[model samples]
Target: MTMLNQMKKSLGLLLLCTVLESHADVLIDVTATMVDPACNIRSENSSSPLAIDFNIINSSELNKSAVVKDFSLYISDCNFSKSLAMVLNPKGGSTLSYNGKNILATSIDGLGIDFTEVTGGTIRALEMNKKQRIYPERVNATLYRMDLQAQLVSAVPIKQLELGEFTSTVTLSVTYN
Candidate 1:
């Protein structure tokens, strides 16, 4: 009986060794992107939820010329970066794309708003997620003032303009390199 038990133990050990030997080696590829930390974003007035009031827009005036309002964003405490961009995403997924332009749709029907980024005398219309260059060149400054403008645009014919109190909300996000 002792001899038989010893044989069974030896056989079990051999099977365990064979099972261990059957294991295969695995190679894994690891990757990661090193992103610069985000900077502090604030309204030009150093307040939350930057707002621009297009006070008392005359519906009839939209046909004469687009109503324009200027606003600013104050950026500070930013990590050293070579460049940065501001991405505009209007809330509620409201937007109007007309004639090769993207406009932010407002609460009022037939009315929309267009945005332009002003950088050092150069003004360019901002496209959705186009990553428009907020920094013309590499910058290391800790404080920055980003100037912008909002222009009232009509999605429908001027005759179809809606009259009432209106509101619009857009979330501004920053990406840095």
Candidate 2:
């Protein structure tokens, strides 16, 4: 072949190889992190019923009441064999009284019932980051708030002692696209 034709052929082959390399698939990496809150439960008397107080904080950036349904809490101990505990449902009202103190029940009002059953609980995600999911679990008795009123009965003794610094971990599961 002529020198000019041979050079043209080599250039054409190089261009073809470059095009093939450029068509190779591109790769991307995705990652997520989950974190639970540090929770502690203490009982003054084993014989008397203990009332635990659970406070929910909207540390996220969301701002809607319906978001409450997106989260759940799971409570278990070192044994991990016993059935999960149950949390008391907040009375439908503007405020709830515990120990002669009036506390708001809804997040909109200010005070929030952040308490939930350690085994199965739910919290609304207000204006939180859309890519993140947080679930708070309870470590001790579900009845964190106690009403020391005339109707109050002797506190129920907490059994199956899982003593020590109990931590109610709030796991955060994130999904990104």
| Candidate closest to the true structure, highest TM-score | 1
Using lDDT, give the best candidate's number. Answer: 1
For 72-156, candidate 1 gives per-residue lDDT tens digits of 7777766545577778888887888855877788898868889988756689888654565685322345677777888888878
For model 1 the local lDDT of residue 160 reads: 81
lDDT of each: 0.78, 0.32
Tell me the lDDT of candidate 1: 0.78
Q: Per-residue alpha-carbon lDDT of model 2 for 1-177, expressed as tens digits?
A: 699899999999999999888856778898888634332323324322343323342333123222232222232222222222222323353343433443324333232333222223233322211232223333465422211111111111223222222212211222211
Clashing pairs in 1: none
